[model samples]
Target: MSLKSFGAKIFASYIRKKIDKWASQPEATQQKVFRELIEKGKNTKFGQDHDFKNIKTYKDFTQKVPIRDYEELRFYVDKMVAGEVDVLWPGKPLYYAKTSGTTSGAKYIPLTKDSMPAHINAARNAILCYIDETGNAKFVDGKMIFLQGSPEMDEKNGVKLGRLSGIVAHYVPAYLQKNRMPSWKTNCIEDWETKVDAIVEETIHEDMSVISGIPSWVQMYFERLQQKTGKKVGELFPNFNLFIYGGVHYEPYRAKFENLIGRRVASIELYPASEGFFAFQDKQNEKGMLLQLDSGMFYEFIRSDEFFEENPKRLTIGDVEKGVNYVIIVSTNAGLWGYNMGDTIQFTSLKPYRVIVSGRIKHYISAFGEHVIGKEVEEAMQEAMRSTKARISEFTVAPQITPENDELPYHEWFIEFEEEPENMDEFHRILEKTLQEQNSYYFDLIEGKILQPLKITTIPRGGFNHYMKSIGKLGGQFKLARLSNDRKIAEVLEENLRKYNK
Candidate 1:
């Protein structure tokens, strides 16, 4: 047996064993987890403020700690950055995950020595679970090329700061590091164009077996590799059998991704964010990821329909029902109290509990009360793309409610396409019809003439790239908001589209 292949088998076996233990647990395990996190932080200021000492059950915890977004959480984070120990998490945060903010300019989410493993372990288990399912241990023996941002970190107050991907890069096991391509020096290059080129140059001929990154950047890397090698991805990296992706939904890009690879590869979907690594795709046949119940975070759910109500009902793990969209509220070991992750999810299964991200609370368009979301638009667009034989590179959507010069209100789509459909009118018709089918409210608006037919404006090839770079958010976990209630992003892309015209 080859030495590296032997090692792959051993590692894969270990991961599968761990996952077996995690999956075999009872639903009551979630309650035990909630108690554990509360006890872990009971001495911290946040814990005390929330009356964690006396909080014994889900109802008590909910009544004590309220749902909060970044704006409310920033004060404690600033205290952490200014050398406060046990402000949020006990002691200082191990790292601060810095992400771009539209209004606040920057957001710093905490990670602790204890809670950091939740992020790392969920990622490792996902690949391991894939190996278990397919018996593909040889992937472990070959190199992996992760298209991540610069690992270089800055300091805030006293805490180290970088993108979550960048921060996590520092902790990749030494054994894996040897087989990972793109030297840290190359990965540290701040400009994405320069970094991707170096990555292509570094790994084009290696024994690459696994690839991981967001879909957009992965597309860029694949394009660059094809340009350099003049061959399909499968031809370039014959050992490649696995693709790990997160940060955004993959269904919209699935067709394009498959075409780029030139062959089918196993795909694992993960639900990871700056706040925590919440879930992982345990089985390919499953519609949603299995929530990581033991991962140092207690989960709570509030029905999205009632989230805007004066008082929303908080549902515990046992109380949640399948097919209802819920805004996730979490209390984590890192000491975030009743933190609203801002991501919306819906359970596809409740026996062991699995969820798919439905949308973002802030990332929606309901300007005319149509109340549309990311998952709805993405699915509609994918269906339209398929029916029309079109391929979009990137896109964003917003409601055009306020008529300018007495124009009709509509939903505007700013899209960049790798292959524009021959029938633009039919392509648009499908988009409008699919959306009407996805959201009844949207359909009613169209039926009532409250909304004009949706409009599409073609963005020049590099319009999204220009916008991301313009905002200093070109890489890592940053992605263009797919839908918004406002037209700010549409305006930027419209101006970029003008450049092509000129």
Candidate 2:
């Protein structure tokens, strides 16, 4: 092994010891984080307004600080954007991670000097954990690429503003700078398509070992690589063995990715957002990402079913149960207090406190009261593909409450196929059956004739990309929602289908 790989192994071992120390005592670590956040936050404007002085317990904290989403918390964020200091955190944030918002246009989440290390360290620890688990640090010597947004940041009131990935681009560590790919110039390209083409040209001949990005965008990069080299990604980059990804689950895209690479490579799933770096996969054989109990953030959960109810109960780590879906809330050093992250997660292991992101709280289909979530649909797709040997590139589900010919309403699945199934009917059947088995409300609706079985709409190859590009969200942290309550995305995809067929 090279000196770099040898050094990486030693570092990985050191990191693992620290991780194990906290992981083994999840509750105690969390209590420390909770106390630290409260102690520091009490002097801030938000803490003062919320009466943080007398907040002595988790119960007191929850009662005093109601759960608020970005919209509710924006009053203080707007103050920070206007050059206010000590508005949320102890002082002004170092940067603002600009993310696309649904109702609020654009959201600028704070990244404080104290909070930035969590983001950087969590990303680094993800890789080190992988190395420590598998003893595969040789990849450290090869080129690495992370397909992301432009690293060129804009400024708002002297605060740097950019996509979270772009912000992370600035912190790629001194050791990995020599190994990082595409150069800063290529990464600064504004257009994703142009940037990807530039990336393919730059890295085609390099010894790439690790590639990181969202699965969909990275899929585009892989397709471009194949077009240029006429070889599988694994063959083109023989050393490429680790794919680090976040933002979306990888299971649905796994078959298509393995086909493109012509082999399977290990992957690390990360649960990160603009708000904070939350969790990362620590074990290759584990089912979920290990929750970051010691990451300078205090976590709370409300059962997703009761999330909208009046005064829902807030549960901390000790109160959580395995397999039950709960909306994740956090109060962080970044000064988000009792913040509703809007994403739902389910614990897989309570001992070390690991979780799988179930779905977004708002991104579910309950049009017919079935209340189907992203996890259910993703699992069903996995089962259908496994049973039928089909390969799907991408897909989305939306409630079609009305159909032509005055037929009963049903769910519509828009899919782009990598390899069309030999038996489309069988594939559809399996998908519907699996969904029915998992979701009782959906099963009841189908059986009771309130809704028809789900139908599949085949989208042309690259149709999803076309739809995304049409809306100016083709790349860089923009992901297609797996489930929508309305027909907004479905309508555009339907239009794309027509345009493609014509």
Candidate 3:
């Protein structure tokens, strides 16, 4: 082995020890993390504004700082954007990670000096931990290609704004950048289609070992690669073994990905957003990610079901129970305090604090008393696909609660298919059966005749993509919400279908 590769392995060993050490004392590490954040930022403007110095305990801290959403926190973030020092954090943030709003306006979340390493190191350790657990590190010697966002960042009052992945790209280790696929220029292309073309041209024959991205965008890249190479991805890059994914659930796209690659590759799931790198898969046999307890972020959980309660119970690490859905609230080094990041998670295990991404707090269908989460919908799609052997390109579900005239209220699905099943009725039957089995409320509604069966509409080719482009949310960091208890997204899908039919 080369000296450089040997050096990489040695450094990875050090990070693995750090991960394992924290795993042994999950709660203690979490407490230390919380205390450290308070200690470090207690003198900052936000800290002083919230009386952080007087806050002696978690209970005291929560009592002092109320939970806030992005809009509520915007005043402080805007001041930071306007070159105000010590407004949120102690100083100006290094960059603002802009989120691609699905149906709403964009948000600029901050990335600070202290917060940057928490994000980068967590990702680095995720891979190192995977290698430690599985004894699979061949990928480390080859390319680690991540389908990242544009490197082009817009500056507002001396603050840089770009997608979190693009911001992350700037922090790629010096060793990996030598083998990271596609030039910075190609990744900076704003057009998704154009970018895919350039990426295909750039990395068609490079020695790729690992690939990472949101499933939809990466699928586009894989499809383009197949068309160009006239071979399965596995055939083109035999060493390709690891896939690290976040942003959306991978179950619905599982079969399609497997088919494209010609085989199943080992995978890891991550729970990262513009807020911070919250968690990543740490165990090969485990279902959930080991939460990052020492990542300079303090996590609080509010029962997901009771998120809108007049004064919802805020639970810390010690109070969180397993198997319950909770909306994640974060206090970060980037100056966010008791902020609701909007993502909902459920603890699959408590001893080591492993969690699964249940759904977005905003993305669920419960209009007819059927509280179907993103995970459930993804599972139903996966089950139906498995049973009927159909594959979908992309899909979204919405509650059609206020039906016009004689139509009964029901859930509606707008789907784009790579290959449609020959028997659509069978596909629906299997999907509906799985959903009913998964969600008791929906089953009860159907049995009581209070709601009709679910509705499925086949979107025309490129219809969803057309809608995305029309709304200026065409690619990178844009994840079409999988479920909503509203008709806004469903209506747009219907409109796109109509336009395509014409």
Candidate RMSDs in Å, in order, are 1.8, 0.9, 1.8
Runs with alpha carbons beyond 4 Å of true place in candidate 1: 1-7, 10-14, 24-26, 403-405
lDDT string for model 2 (1-502, tens) is 9999999999999999999999999888989999899889888899899888998988888778999999999999899899988889997889999998869899999999989999999999999999899999999999999988888899998999999989999999999999998799999998889999999999999999999999999999999999988999999999999999999999999999999999999999998899999999999998999899888899999999999999899999999999999999999999898899799999999878999999999999999899999999999999999999899989999998878999999999999999988999999999999999999999999999999999999988899888889999998588999999999999999877777778
> Where does candidate 2 clash, by residue pair?
none
Give the true-structure RMSD of model 1: 1.8
Cα displacement (angstroms), candidate 3, residue 370, comes to 1.9
Put down candidate 3 lDDT per residue, 207-314, tens digits, no spaces.
Answer: 889999999989989999999988999999999999999988888889899999999999998888778899999887888998988888888999987998899999
lDDT, model 3, position 183: 87
Per-model TM-score on C-alpha atoms:
0.96, 0.99, 0.96
Q: Quote the lDDT for 420 in model 1.
A: 93
lDDT of 1 by residue, 1-502 (tens): 5676676667778877766675567356777888788888788888887788998877788788888888888888778888889888789998998887657888888888988998998998887777677777787778997878788999977789898999989889887888886798999999888888888889887989999999988988898888888899989899899999998988888777777889888899999988889998988888899888888888888988789998888877878889887999987887777789789999898766789999998899999888899989998899889998898889899888786898779999988888899899989988988899889999998899888889998887777888999877787567878999998888777777777689
Report residue 295 deviation for candidate 1 (angstroms).
0.5
Top of the candidates by lDDT: 2
Provide the global lDDT of candidate 2 against the true structure: 0.93
Candidates' lDDT values, in order?
0.85, 0.93, 0.86
Better of 1 and 2 by lDDT: 2
| Model 3 spans > 4 angstroms off | 1-8, 101-104
Ranking by lDDT: 2, 3, 1
